[model samples]
Structure formats: C-alpha cells, structure tokens
Target: MRILIVEDNALLAQGLSAMLEALGNEVLGVAGDAESFVTAVLADRPDVAVVDVRLPPSFTDEGVRAALHARELLPGLPVLVLSQYVEDTYARELIADGTGVGYLLKDRVARVDDFLDALHRVAAGGTALDPEVVRQLLATRSDPLTRLSRLSRLTEREREVLALMAQGYGNVEIADRLVVTERAVHKHVGNIFLKLDLPPEDSGDRRVLAVLTHLGAPRRTARDGRDGRG
Candidate 1:
C-alpha cells in the first residue's frame, strides 16, 4: 500500500516513514505542516494518510482541520489520525462521517502489529477508533441525567457491546474480550441497533451510526421494556 505521513515532529515522521517502508508499503512523502500535508495528499493521492492531531504554528488542531479539508477535496479518502491525548472533539469530528477513517492514540504505535492493523483497516474503508478515545467520549457528558436517560433503553450488557463496537472491535474480538460466544456478541449488537432505532443497513455503517448515536447529545425518549438476549 502507498501511504503518506503528516507529522510535524521530524523524528517521529522519519520513524513512521521507515516503519511503513520496512513493512513493504510505499511512503509517498512526509509533510510537517497542514499546508504541505494537504498538498501531498492532493498531489499523490496515496492509499492511506497517517496524520498527527496537532501540526505546525499553533500545534493545536491544524492536522484535524487539514485532514477534513483533504477529505473534502478527495471524498472517501482513507485517513488515520494519531494523537498524543484523547481529544474527544477532534475524534468525534473525524468519525462523524464514519468509514475510511481512524483516530488512535500515539502510544498505540509502539504496539507495531496493532498499529499496522489499524492502518490497514482504515485503508480498507473500515473504522479503527482507539478504545481510550471511545471511553473518553462516553465519559465526557455535560448532563449526567440526560446521558443516563438517553441510554436507559439499553441493557448493561448491550451497552458494553456497543462500547466495544465503537472501539472498532468486531464480534469475534468483542466476544473474546467479554468471554462470551461470538453469536452472543452479534445478538447484543443487533439489539443495540434495534433499541437505538437505527434502520436496517450495512452492518459496518450501523456500527458507526450506533457509536454516533451514543456520542451525540440527543433528547431522551421513552424506553422499550424488552429484555435483551445474551
């Protein structure tokens, strides 16, 4: 796969570039700032782009903004953003559109295999959100009562399954984590969609939408009293 790196830290950028190349993937180029990152992206059109959440000058959310702009220029372009901290706002913005995107903590890169897996997942138009990011998003609520009311429809187990799904874990991985059968995880996922009133669609899209629904500040509604299986 051909990849592009957008990190302001020269050492980190070189390290990432070397890692990608060592894995037999082509490294198009490394851009240290937002402008250069967008330029490289529009010009090379690489298979995937690995970006840092912060960039030159402000070192704030320049990378996030640049990434959004690049996607605007090249719709559906796969992008995997690496961040040092859990910036819930930026993470939500990246996954707002769903597929072909990922937001992982910079620490995960030390886990070479897992990091590569996330990169490939994003490259294949799949989501790869960090579990820490999901946890932070779930916990960052202004109104505890409203948040509880909105999620009151879901059973404890179903909520657990949904959180794992938001973290980009598949049924098998979720099952492994929860020490349950894969079928049980699938059933929980289905129930989550049903209780959330998400329409029937591709399972991947439903997974993302379910996460968005959980993260978004929607009004509380009446709850269905049905018990979830598994």
Candidate 2:
C-alpha cells in the first residue's frame, strides 16, 4: 500500500514511516501540519492516509479536518487515524465516512504486526478500530437496538460473533478464534444482521454499519472544524 502520514511530532512520524516501509508498504510522504497534509493529498494522492488527531498551528483537530477535506476532494479515500487520546466524537465522525477507515490509539503501533494488519485492512477498503473505541460504542445505551426485547432475539453465540464483528474481526478470523467452522460463523453473522433488521450487504465488511447499529442512529457528521464534543 502507498501511505501518506500526517503527524506533527517529528520522531513519531519518522518511526512510523520506517515501520510502515519495513512492513513492505511505501511511505509516499509525511505532512507535519494540516496545510501540507492537504497539499500532499491533492498532489500525491497516496492509496491511504495515516493521520494524527492533533496537528500543527492550533493543534486541536487540524489533522482530522485535513483528512475530511481530502475525502471531500477524493471521496472514499482510505484513512487510518492515530491518536494519543481516545475521542469518541472523532471515532464516530470518521466511521460516519463509511468504509476504508480506522481509528486507533498511538500506543497500538507498538504492536507492529497488528498495526500493519489494520493499516492494510483500511487501505484495502475495510474497517478497523481500537478495542477501546469498540467498547465505547457498545456501551452507548441510547441505541434502541440495545433494548432487551430486541437484543434477546440473538442467541449467546450470535452475540459473541456480533461483538467480534464490532472489533473488526473478519468471519474467518472469528471462526478460527472461536474454533468454529467458517460456515457457522457466516450463518451466525447473517442471523445477527437479520435480527437487528439491518440490510445485508454481500461483502459483509460493513464494520462501520455494525457499529452504527450499536449507536442506534444514522451516520452523523461533525460540524465545520468541530468533531462533535464528547
């Protein structure tokens, strides 16, 4: 995958670039601030962008703004955002963009193999999120789907599969981890989607859609320059 990095910290950016290159992905360039990030997007247009949540000048959320703008210019462009902090609002907004997205903590990069796996998944038009982000979304009680009557429709095993799906595990991975047949996992996934009244997509990589179901609302957009406040 060809990746463009948007981060202000020089050491971290260099380390990430080196790590990604070592993992066999090409690092197209690094942008320290939002302006350069947008410039790189318009000019170079790498296959994926790995961005920091906070960036130069104001350092509030310039990186995400730049990423959103890049997506505006190039809709559905892949982005994997890394943050030192877990901002639920940021996660929700990014996921609202639909697919080919990831939001992970900076600490996750230390787990090099897993981080590379997630980056590749995002670049290949899939979805990934930090485990904590999944937890936060799952814990949102406002979701009408979480009501006992609706949730009671799922068997315990199916619920387990739903949780794993929210964690960005593909059916094959879920099957391997649960020691079940891939066919069984697929059946459970279909059942879960059906019980939740979600329309089935043939690809089944709709991790963002699954998360939105947990949130019990349609995808939301943040206002100009403001990720919805926590």
Candidate 3:
C-alpha cells in the first residue's frame, strides 16, 4: 500500500514513515502543513493517508480539515487521523462522513502492531477508532439508549457484543474477549441487526450505523423486538 504522511512534527513523521515502510507499505510522500498535505494527496493519490489532527500555521484542526477536503476530492479515500486527546467533536465529524476513516489517539502508535493493524483496516475500507475514544463518546452522552428502543430486544450478552463492536472490535477479537466462538459472535451480530432492523453490511458501515443508533441517534427500525404479547 502507498501511504501519505501528513504531520508537522518532523521527528514523528520520520518515525511513522520508517515504521510503515518496515511494515511493507510504500511511503508516497510527507507533508508538514495543510496546503502541502492536500497537494501531496491530490498529486500522488496514495492508497491511504496517515494524518495528525493538528497541523502547522494554526495547529488547531488543519489536519482533520485537510483530510476531509481530500476525501471530498477523492471520495472514500481511506485516511486515519491521530490526535493527542479524546475529542468527541472530532470523532463525530469523522464518523459523520460515513466512509473509510478512523480517529485514534497518538498513544496508540506506540503499540506498533495494533497501530499498523488499524491502519490496514482503515485502508481496506473498514473503521478503526481507539477504544478510549469510543468510551469517552459513550460517557459524554446523557442517554445512550434514548433513540434505541430496540435495546430491550437484545439479550445482555448481545448488548455486550454491541458495546465492543462500537469500540471497533472485529468478530474474532470480540469472540476472544468474550470467550465465545467466532460463530457465536456472528450469531449475536446478526440477531442484533435483525432486532435493530439494520441491514447487514460487510464493509463495517452497518456496524457503525448500529453504534450510532445505540448511542441515541434515531435510525430506521424495520421491526419491533417484542412479539406484541408483552
């Protein structure tokens, strides 16, 4: 995979470039500021872009804005934004785009293997958000079940699975965490979708949609969870 690195910190950018290269991906280019970041992406059209949430000139959210702009130009272009802290607003903006994107804390990069795994996931058109980011998101919410009346339909174990899914765990990982077979996880996922009236999707979009629904945002529900006898 060809990757573009957009970070103002020269040392970190160099380190990330080296790490990605060592992991068998080509480094397309490195950009220090917003303008240069957009330029490199548009010119090179790499397979993925690793961006910092803060960039030069103002260092506010230039990196995130640049990544969004690049996505506007090249829709579905996978990009992962790294931030120093858990910012719900940033995560919401990235998730709102509803495409190949990720928001991870900078600390995650130290876990080299996991960081690379997340990068590859986002590059392959899947979502990868840091667990802390997801936790903060849920914690900041006043009522996570406000819009999700279907919550009652899910068994406690299924609710557990959904929580982990919102944290960006894949089936195998969730199974390992829950001490269940992957098949069992698959079953619960399907049932959750059915109960929530969400169409199954392989690209991970539906899972995120379900998470959004679980987080009190109303989405279309196709069926009632109860048999109407209760």
Candidate 4:
C-alpha cells in the first residue's frame, strides 16, 4: 500500500517511515505539521496513512483534526492514528467514523507484526483498537456502557463474547480467535441478543450496531477472569 506518514516528531516519523517501508509499502510523504499533513494526504491520496495523535503548533489534537478532515477530503481513505495515551474523547471521535479506522497506543507499534497486521486490516476496511483501550472505554460512566453492564449481567458467556463481536469478528472468525466451536459462537450470540433486549427486527446490520454501541462503551461485569454473577 502507498501510505503517508503524518507525525510531528522528526525522529519518530523517520523511524515509522523506515519500518513501514521495510514491510514493502511506499511511504509517499511524511508531514511533521498539521497543514503539511492535510496537504500531503489530499495531494497523494494513498491507500492508507499513519498519523500521530498530536501534531505541530498545538500538538494536542492536530492529528485528530487531520483525521476528521481526511474523512471529508479523502472520504474512504483508511487511516491509523497511533497515540501515546488513550484519551477517551479522541477514541470516541475516531470511532465515530465507524470503519476503515484504527486508534492504538504508540506502544503497540513495538509489537511490529501485530501493528502491521492492524494496518493491513484497517486498510482493507476494518476497525482496529487496542484491547486495553477497549477495556478503558468500557469502564467509563457513558450511558451505553451502563446499559451494556445491565445486558452483561444476563449471561455468563455473553459478556465474554461481546468484545470479539465488536472487534468485527464473524462467527467463524470469533471461534478461531476464542478457540471455540462455531455452533457455540452462534448460541452465545443468540443469547446476547435476547439478553440485550434487542428489537424484533434486530438482525444483521442492526445486530452490528447493537454490538458496536455495547462495546463502544462496554461495561466490564467481571473481576479478573471471574464473572460478577454467581
């Protein structure tokens, strides 16, 4: 894939460009500031772009601003924003785009293979977020998370199953990921719908929304590996 690198830190940007290049992809242009970031993306229209969470000038959310702008400028262009921290609002804003997007901590980049895998997946139209980031999101006092907590209480396995579902895994995909049977995945998903009190018409796309909303701010109902339920 031809990709752009939008990051303010010079050394980090150079390092990321080198690594991405080693993976057999072109790094079209590396921009160290917000204006240049936007310009490079609009000019090149690469397959995917890796952006920092913060950029020049403010360095607070310039990358976030660039990502939002790319949504309008490039439309379907896939983007992966790496950050040093999981700012709740930043995650919320990125997730709003719904697909072909990834928000992960900079630390995850150290896991080179997984990081590249995430890039490839996102470029191929997938959602990618760190597990701990998801965990942190679900732990907040958001309305959706609260409801998911109530929904989570209804079953033993459903809560465990919900995360994989939100991560864009299908029955077979989730089965392999969780080391479970396909039939078991189906049964757990069915129970999830019933327990969550989904609408009668909730199937397919609607089901995806339910899981997304639930996981968007999912509340954890377990302590460690133990379920909260008796």
Candidate 5:
C-alpha cells in the first residue's frame, strides 16, 4: 500500500513511517500540520492516509478536516484517523462520510500488528473503529439502525463475514480469508444486509457506514433477531 502520514509529532511520524515502510508499503510523506498534510495529499496521492486527529496551530480537528477534504478531493482515498486522546465527534463525522475510514486511539499504535491490520482494512475500503468510539456511538443509538442491527441470525461463518464487513473488508478479500469464492461471499454479504433491514443505497464500500452504525448500536442477539448481542 502507498501510505501517507499526516501528523505533527515528529517522533511519532518518523516511527510510523519506518514501521509501515518496513512492512513493505510505500511511505509517501509525513507532514507537520494540516496545510502540509493537504499538500502531501495532493502531491503524493497515497492510496490511504494515516492522519492525526489533532495537528499544530490549534491541536484540534485540523486532521479531521483535512481527512474529510481529502475524501472529497480524492474519492476512494481511504483515511485512518488516530488520536492520543479519546473523542467521538470525529468518529461520528467520519462514519457519516460513509465507510473506508478508520478511527483509532494512539495507544493502538503500541499494538503494531493490530494497527497495521486496521490500516490495510481501511485502505481496502473497510471501516475500523476504536472500541471506545464504538461505545460512544452506541450511546446515541438510533432506533431504526439499532433494530436492524439485531436482525443478523447469522451462522458462525456468516457472523465472521458480518464482523469483517463491519471492519471494512471487501467480498473478495473476505472470501479469500474464509477460503471461499468471491461469488459466495457476495451472496452472504447480500443476505447479511437484507437481514439487517438496510435499504440498498450506494451498494459500494460506503456500505460500511450502515454496518458501523448498526454494530455500534446496542448489542443484538443473533438468534432472537428482536432483542438486543452484537
């Protein structure tokens, strides 16, 4: 993957660049602030952007703004937003943009494997959320989405697919992971969404938004499909 780091912390940026590069992915540029980050986005055109939730000047949502702008400017350019501090507003906004985006805590970086895994998933047009952020979204749960999220009377394999979709995996990759044909994966995905009571909208990677919103709702039982196990 071709990755860009839009972070102000010099040490963290360099460390991330080194690690991703070591993982055999291209490290395009590491920017110090929002302007430079936007510049890097235009110049490098990375397949994915790993951004800090805060940047210099205000140390507020500059990175989030840049991420949203980048998504608008470069369609299908997935972004992974990270922060040392916990926040849900940004995560909600990100999900509101649709899927192929990730919001993770900086502490997650300590778990390099998990962090990279999330990065790959995001780049491939999947969604990844910090557990805390998920909890926060759950607090504002919508009745419709919440009700639908409970409809998955999924088999273990179906649940695997559903969890992966919530994580932003495409059918092809999901099929490969489960050692099934992409065609079969597609059928399973369709079934999962149908069971969830979601209207077919874009029917693209943006589908992750619906999935995230559902998963973040109150947990739902797989069997009952009427009670709240997710």
Candidate 6:
C-alpha cells in the first residue's frame, strides 16, 4: 500500500516512515503540517493517509481539518488518525462517514502488528477505531432517555457484542475474545442489527452502522455470561 504521513514531530514521522517501509509498504512522503499534508495528498493520492491529530501553526486540530478537507477533495479517501490522547469530537467527526477511516491513540503504534492491521483495514475501506474512543463515545450521552430508548431492545449479550463491534473487531475475533463460537457470535451480531433496526442492505455497511448506533447510546456494562451459550 502507498501511504502518506502527516505529523509535525520529526522523529516520530521518521520512525513511522521507516516502520512502514520495512513492512514493504511504499511511504510516499511525510508532511510536517496541514498545508504540506494537503499538498501531498493532492500530489500523491496515496492509498492511505496516516495523520497526527496535532500539527504545526495551531497544534490544535490542524490535522483533523486537513484530513476532512482531503476527503472533500477526494471522497472516500482512507485516513488513519493518530492522537496522543483520545479526542472525542475529532473521533466522532472522522467516523461519522463510516468508511475508510481509523482513529487510534499514538501509544498503539508501539504494537506494530496492531497498528499495521488498522492501517490495512482503513486502506480497505473498513473502520478501525480505538477501544478507548469507543468507550468515550458510548459514555458520552446528552439525553439519558434517548439513549435508553435506542438501546433498550438490546439484550445484555447483544450489547457486549455491539461494544466489541464498535472497537472494529470481526466476528471471529469477537468470538475468541468472548469465548463463544463463531456461529454464536454471528447470531449475536444479527440480533444486534435487528434490534437496532439496521437491516441488511445492498448499499452501506451494516457493521459500521451498528457501531455508530452503539456509540450513540449510553454505556451499559454487559453481565458476565461468557461461560453461557451465546
């Protein structure tokens, strides 16, 4: 995969570039600021963009704004945003489109395999959100009644499945984590879709929709039922 990186930290950018190249992916170039980032995007049109949440000038949300603009210029452009901390608003905005996007903490890059997996997933037009980001989204609710209304139909097990889904885990991975059969995980996923009123559609991703629904609702801890049949 061809990748463009946007990060102001020189050493971190160099390290990331080296890591990606070592893995056989083409590192187009690293941009130090939002302007250069956008310029590189227009020039290279890379398979995926690995961006930092903070960049030069303002160091607030320049990377986020640049990423959003890049997508505007090239719709469906894949982006994997790296942040030092979980920024709730930035994460929500990036995943709002529900395709070819990822938001992860900078600390996650230490686990090279997982970081690469997330990059590849985003490049293939799949969501790869940080578990912490998922938790924050689930926990941030404006209206308690609205949250209850949305997720009231979900069983405790279904909520557990949905939470894992929001963290971008596949059915097989979720099954392994939950100590359930793959078939059982599939059933739980289906039930989640049904309860959330997310039907199978030829267009749009139901998994992403389910995750979004899970994020919209208030956080609910699932009962310990991993030993029971899923």
Please report the candidate that would top TM-score against the real structure: 1
TM-scores for candidates 1 onward, in order: 0.87, 0.85, 0.82, 0.82, 0.70, 0.86
lDDT, candidate 4, 68-163, per-residue tens: 687667776788999999887777666665467788899999999779977987898777777666667666636765666666565656766766
Q: Tell me the number of clashing residue pairs for each predicted model.
A: 0, 0, 0, 0, 6, 0
> For residue 50, what is the lDDT in candidate 4?
92
What is the alpha-carbon lDDT of model 1 when measured against the actual structure? 0.81
Candidate lDDT scores, in order, read 0.81, 0.78, 0.79, 0.73, 0.75, 0.80
Name the lDDT value of residue 110 in candidate 5: 86
Candidate 6 per-residue lDDT over residues 70-182, each given as its tens digit: 88787778999999998888887777644788999999999988898889988988878888888788777556676677688888888888777876778888899999998
Candidate 5, residue 35: how far the Cα is off, in Å: 0.9
Error of 5 at 92 (Å): 1.3
Return the top candidate by lDDT: 1
Better of 2 and 6 by lDDT: 6
* Candidate 6 C-alpha error for residue 151, in Å: 3.7
Worst 10 residues of 6 by lDDT: 221-230
Off by over 4 Å in 2: 141-149, 207-217, 220-230
Identify the superior model by TM-score, candidate 3 or candidate 5. Answer: 3
Q: Flag regions of model 5 displaced more than 4 Å.
A: 142-165, 169-197, 200-207, 213-230
> What is the C-alpha lDDT profile of model 5 across 100-204, one tens digit per residue?
789899999889888988898788777787766655554555564654456436656776776666555678878988999998888888777777676655255
